[model samples]
Target: MTGYLVRRVGQMGLTLFLIITLTFFLVEAQPGDYASFYVLNPDLPPDVKEKIRAAFGLDKPLWQQYLIHLKNTFTGNFGVSFGHFPRPVMDVLAERIPRTLVLFLTATAASFYLGFFLGKAIAWRRGGLFEYVATISGATLFTAFTPAFALMMIWIFAFRLDWFPLWGNSCIGGLALDILKHMVLPVATLTLISFAGTMLLTRNSMLETIREDYVMAARAKGLPERQVRDRHAARNAMLPVVTSLVYSLIFAIDGSVIIEGVFSWPGTGMTLLSAVRSEDLPLVMGAMLFIGCCRCWLT
Candidate 1:
């Protein structure tokens, strides 16, 4: 187990290195740097543009910039953000990370519980109408276009029914209840789309597990049906489901980019989007690196 863990960690380190390198070059390859808007203005003289580049170290050669970025990344010094000027990249991300965690973690828990419960029920009663209905519905939802579904949910719940706020993270006063209220639509959107996959996986796993010899032995021993199902079948079926749960939680960090954007949530996802649009290389690179690290180590 020690050797296995060491190997996994080493692989994750290599993957993270590749992710950092690729992100740096891709971001640098963009047509203009953070000062492009100021540099491109017709009124700005050549000297001013040169000054702007010098201020941000854009005057450095590409290789030098890459090396500097790599060194800073390893040292956990993500420099000041071009978008949120005068603020360090880490400081900007610090404020946003908690919001993203709250939203995605809550959604993941909700989806897993709902999916697992429904999956077990449907699998246990294999031939029932409820099983068919749930399977069909789950498949449909699993295949739905995420952004469009989110928009439709907003239209129905927020716009048409006025049941929830249209967007944004919180209301005035920043009450916990107000924050939860704002989270409802986006959280529900993510949960609804996600639960289907979990449900199907659980259902399939349960089906296979129930056919195993150990399950039949449990039943043959005159165990109560519920005991036989829960203690025997469901417990064993959980192996694959647990793996799926880990992946869901890890990737949800990256997935938040879209969900947060649609709901106007004040999370890292929205922060990254704004940074990219504004050509904030430090902030963007920091966010990408943070996400890559999460995906790597958390697995």
Candidate 2:
């Protein structure tokens, strides 16, 4: 297991390097530099633009910049954010990442386990009305567009009913209850979508497991129906569901930009969106690379 883990870590490092290199060049190739965005003032002198470029090392050759970026990345410095002036990219992420993690982990954990057990229960009673209704609901949710669904939720819960706060992460140093109140809409949006996928996969896996000879033999032994279902069928069916749960948790670390945007949740996803809009290449690249690492490591 140690040797396998070593190999996997090595592969993750190599893949991360390629991702950073490719992302850097692709972002560089985009039209207009970050300096241009700041050059909007008609009276801003050409020398001022040069100063801005020089300060951020954009005036250097692309090769030199790439090398410096690579070194800094290795040393845990993600460079300064061009959009936010001199603020370090890592500093910006530090404040936001924890919030994203809290929200994402909470939503994913709740959805994953709930959906898994719900799926198992439904699978055990496959032909009942409850099973049919749940199956249809899960299928519908899986097919729904994430951003649109989030918007619908915001409109209904926040705008129309005003049950939850419309946006933001709540007041700083606020009570835990206040923070949770603010989280409801965004968490619910992610939960429902994630639940659909988990439930369907779990149900399918359970269905397949129950048909296996081992399950029949367990039943023939006169074991209780619950034991046959839980110990024999559900145990084997959990393999695939667990895999899905892990991937979902890892990717959820990236957060949902659209949902965050709609709800104005100040998390990493919202930060990434702002960085992209302002053409902050360093910040954008940093955020993307971090998210990519999370995904690659888990997969």
Candidate 3:
């Protein structure tokens, strides 16, 4: 395991390096320089703009800028934010990463576990109420619906009707309850968007596994139904789910941006999104490379 981890980490590092190189060139390839933002602004004087560009080494040769950027990056300096005053990109990101993480980690854990157990139950029962309802409720909707609309439906039906809280964060006051409160809408949203795909995948895969020769052999040997299902069928059925879930986690990390944007939650995803929009090269590249390395890890 130790050797495996070491190899994976090294591979992740190489993947990240390549991401940095690729993004650096791509960002540079976009129209105009970072200084152009100021130069085109009606309010800024040309002389001050030149000085700002010079000070930030924006006026330097591209190769020199790349070398300097890499050196600073190696030393943990992600560079100054063009938008924020007296703030480093890393610091800005660090402050928000936790809150965004809270939203995603909460939503994902809820989505995956609930989907897994419910899916397994539905698979076993096949034609039951849970199966029918889960198939219907989960099948037609997705994250495509407006978040607020869905949340409002849940709030009016579930919370206003006494099913759950309408708005709250579980991160403070009382750790568990606060989390439950804040988690209500976002978790529900994620779960709703997530349930159908997972359920369908698990149900289909599990049905296939139960019919396999090994499961039949176990049954012939008089293993209990539960034992046959869990030991033989469950493990095999879940292998793909486990791998897919890991890939989903990587997507969660990057995809959190949109959900974060919707919820006004802070996380690396939104920060990266902002960086891309602002054309803050260092921050954009840092985020892209970080996300890419994470994706490589999942793969």
Q: How far out, in Å, is residue 275 in model 3?
A: 4.4
As a whole number from 0 to 100, the lDDT of residue 3 in candidate 1 is: 100
> Candidate 3 on 1-299: residue-level lDDT in tens?
99998998898788867777777789889986666655777788878889978977888999998888778767888876665323776777677667666776777777777767777778878998878988887776644564565556566755678665543322434576665555566666776677566677788889988889999999999999889877888888987776667666776776766665554444667677777777676667666666676677677
Task: Show where candidate 3 strays beyond 4 Å.
Answer: 1-14, 29-48, 127-132, 142-180, 212-232, 274-282
Q: Write the per-residue lDDT of candidate 1 for residues 188-254, one digit (tens) a residue.
A: 9888888988898999999999999999999899999999988999989999998999899886887
TM-score of each: 0.91, 0.87, 0.74
Model 2: residues with Cα > 4 Å off, grouped in runs = 1-6, 34-45, 84-86, 211-224
**Number of the predicted model whose lDDT against the real structure is largest:** 1
Candidates ranked, most accurate by lDDT first: 1, 2, 3
RMSD of each: 2.2, 2.7, 4.5
RMSD of 2: 2.7
- Which residue pairs in model 3 clash with each other? 158-163, 168-182, 169-178, 169-182, 170-178, 170-179
Q: What is the clash tally of candidate 3?
A: 6
Ranked by TM-score, the better of candidates 1 and 2 is: 1
Q: Look at candidate 2 and give me any clashing residue pairs.
A: none
